[model samples]
Target: MKSGPDDLAIHQKIQISRRTAGLLLGSCLVRPAKVLASADPLTNKIVVRSQLSAGDPGRLMNVFAKAYRGEPITLGVIGGSITVGAFATTKENSYAGRLLTWWRQQFPRCEVRMVNAGVGGTGSMYGALRAGKDLLSNTPDFVVIEFAVNDNWTDGEAFEGLVRQILAQPNLPAVLLLFMMWEKGGNDQEMQANVGAHYQLPMVSFRDALWPEMAAGRLNWSDYIVDTVHPTDAGHAAAARFITAMCNNARHADLAGRSGATSSLPSPLHSDAFEHIDWRDAAALDPHENQGWHLDFDDKGVAAWNAAAAAGRIAFDWSGTGLVAVFADPLLDPRRIRFRIDGASFQTLDTLKQPKRPILVLAQDLTPGRHIVELVDDDGGSGRAAGQQVRLIGIAGIGLKDDWRR
Candidate 1:
């Protein structure tokens, strides 16, 4: 894929020690913080009440009820650079972090857990595939999804599938959809809102609440937003305020402390292709590589195998269907890479195409079973005497039938 303005990748530090890297990878969340917004909240005509499209609040209210009972609650957030705290600097300064702080403040007695599963430069297609591995694995009691900026209108099914996957969790976690916006006003809310409505979910929009202030000259976009997509701390704080407003509604309006209400998930909006998806990070897979290949890290510090010659090789195993190979443009070179699934003939893919990320569906309908996959660098031969390259990031796939609905 080609790197451009849209790819506002949050490049994590790689030179840090393993201990520091573990925290960066979200192994363990830090303690409660006194982190505050860098600037004061601005006054505007935007209505917080109107910004919330309340669907069935049964599940959300349950979370509020549980918290009041002093029970533990886990909060999860997944998205792109914005959710990962791009321009906000630290996680504690992020909108997600601000939301977590607001939660602790509301219920001081309850123990709240946080899982920040945001990897920059990724959209819902990748989110759907990695949600299980990252967010759901923590068994969060409540989750916030904020992919509005990273994903486009065409990502409806993948986004819907991500929601279904989280809702289908055995623990019955509550899902909240959050919509962020661009400096000039653009987001995936219209398309994403369709999925939210179908499932009767609690949805909040920062754009609806704050865009008018920018458009009407009541608020300067430069003062809040960092660039085209990422937001400054004040921008993030404004968005956090919208989320807290919804949470407050869930606590007070969704029936003050009594909630045993149950709700069934609606049928699929498009296809349930992502409900059982899983991602195999390059680091965890420990792929075997040739001498011609050098190891690297993606923007998120996840392992990436960089091929420097045609003889470079990478081999790994992945199961089920909807198989995808995620390539990291470590060198940003327009090169070719070839691969084979289950010993099938090698299929060639040219890297760094114009618009999309180098995420390819190697096999969309593989037989539901384990499969062997291998990649051989298709750059110039080992003796080419050139160091140009391509990098293999991670591999993901949908699960098998016996793996349950999720």
Candidate 2:
């Protein structure tokens, strides 16, 4: 993370096509995250200078001013497993939970509300798809986004889209970018930092502080992580401190300078396709479509069609220039996922070779309008339909009717 936002690489001058713009401003939906709760034992305000990047504290000025006034404030966070408190002894021991504790300490008189919209094994694409419904619906005044460890695909288009979406919220929330790392020091923080720098958002990195220590044998990675990715209770505490310091930095920022954070949303930092999106899960499908579909949670308890081959002729309606579908995981064997737009020719998605939560872009650049989709359950017996073991997630579109596709 950098201390300035004047990166020559900020190429948001590129414009989004009119058709793509229309695809935005619709409703969307996706899985809900486990609410973040509990207390953090470490109360000391620790600011690791190396881990802190002031970026743009513009939006945060108002948040701190609100805290100083002892006014109520709302906070929202979106991220993957680590943000979900994975590997922590308890949800409260997760960094999110600890931050909740820290916020209370700084402004005891100000009531703080939090919405933890963290899901396991998901990334910016999923975050962008569901953020409106999951995180922004509550109208948070401050938001934290952590996807570096999970946004394995795309350079940063999806990440940029997610950031832009949050900034576009009416609340004008203060946004913070958080980057977590794997034990081996592998992560997408560098890629994600570009988006943070472009937006001049405050960023805190746990890897910068701990990774070198681990390399020098001064800090035992196992002491902070029981696995290669998820952090241990100690690890969560370590991360929470940097976040606390960043918050302090924002609180102490020049108020007059930060007042300008409300500048008009910039042009496409990358592609705006993800800027406005709508996600539809099985819950949004016609009840009659449930005939062949057996609704069941996956091993991780995420609601999905464990056996969609049983869901006969499922259907739904969407209006957009593009559409996509999310599947639970890679197919154990070669398979096909078949669907059609407006009853047009069937589009087939051969089973994904990607890892968990593989997505298939069903269609793109189609004429914008209300289009119905029909999904068939195929038993893989030399058939044109989707495979029998198909576990269908919900469908999504770029345009829709409803808050920007909730």
Candidate 3:
């Protein structure tokens, strides 16, 4: 019998199209077996590093207790979907959920309460904005930040703001930055490392370790990631394993033996540079039915696009005539789209004109360079559909290049 899209595998494939899938890959679905190393009773002191550097001979015993088995320590986790476990079937199955479970098991006597503060598509700007209420309000003993995957655009200035908010808590919470990844763009790990060192904090680079593991058979990339960007249940488990291992190692360090010296850790691995964009709703552009305009091809599936159809290109470019548009047919609120670019902003061919329908203008006259562009609904305004009112078909453009065709 032939299988249909209703198959479990097929459904999993469809789920990967969302941004949530990418961030939630490394939770706790795949639990790696623990290898207990014999404890060293003589080891007492450990040298603690101010940041992500190699440290003194510290004992991981206490860390293991604190992270997994210690008393009812309240851990507050904040970030985008990764912390929320978007791909996971439920919140209880998320990394945060699993970590709390492991903490309970590791320290049977301890009570663990986890506060999850994750909002999809939000950046550090949003993280900082909500820290007081979402994170600090609970007075957590420790906080973990995982904005690396969702907010690579966060810079030193943003880091300062985030740090200030996190430090404002009365407990002087221990902060852990877990650097995550996307398919491409700016070195997100680098950004995390810089921020971590500036704050003299502990940092974990899943991207740094996972890239090499994916290359080796020790770990399966497919088990962890559904796409180049997101992770599968297996992938999330792999992430959980990495975090567990790191925590285990930290606990095993002999912190009592170290007098008081600190070391510097290397910056997290850098990713390719990406043109940063702050999503916004733009006035609709003219929808032309000109013969010159035609839909083109796009590898990334068009979900929140102006229109979607396999028969035609989901996007288009005008042939040097200087204009084009993906008109809002049904007129949905929060009508938004993505336009990838390599350099600066491009010229808005229809800057002077505004159409009755909703649309976003992705210009082509800005920085001259390579760029991948896509349009997505910014989750802003709202409207209903009238039997496919939006059109992704190519309408018109003034001076577009031949290479711009689908």
Q: Report the lDDT tens digits of candidate 3 across residue range 253-297.
A: 423242323333333222101112122112222322222223333
Which portions of model 1 miss their true places by more than 4 Å? 1-45, 49-52, 89-91, 256-260, 286-301, 311-315, 330-335, 342-345, 350-355, 380-388, 403-406
Q: Give the best candidate by lDDT.
A: 1
Cα RMSD for candidates in order = 11.1, 10.6, 16.6
Answer with 2 or 3, whichever has the higher TM-score.
Answer: 2
Weakest 10 consecutive residues, lDDT, candidate 3? 41-50
Best TM-score among the predictions, by candidate number: 2
Global lDDT scores for all candidate models: 0.71, 0.69, 0.46
TM-score, structure 2 vs. true: 0.79
Which of 1 and 2 is ahead in lDDT? 1
- For model 2, the stretches where C-alpha displacement exceeds 4 angstroms are 1-52, 254-261, 287-312, 351-356, 381-388, 399-406
Task: Encode model 1's per-residue lDDT on 1-406: one tens digit a residue.
Answer: 3444322221111112222322322321233222221233443224342244656667888888789899999999999888889999677778989999999988999999899999888888788878887888899998989999877734576788899989988878888888888867888776787778678777777787678778888778887788988888888887787676566656654453456486777778777766766677666666544557767776767687777656567777766776777776432333456777778887665431334466766676767777778787756443234454476778876644555322
Kindly give the number of clashing pairs for every candidate. Answer: 0, 14, 76
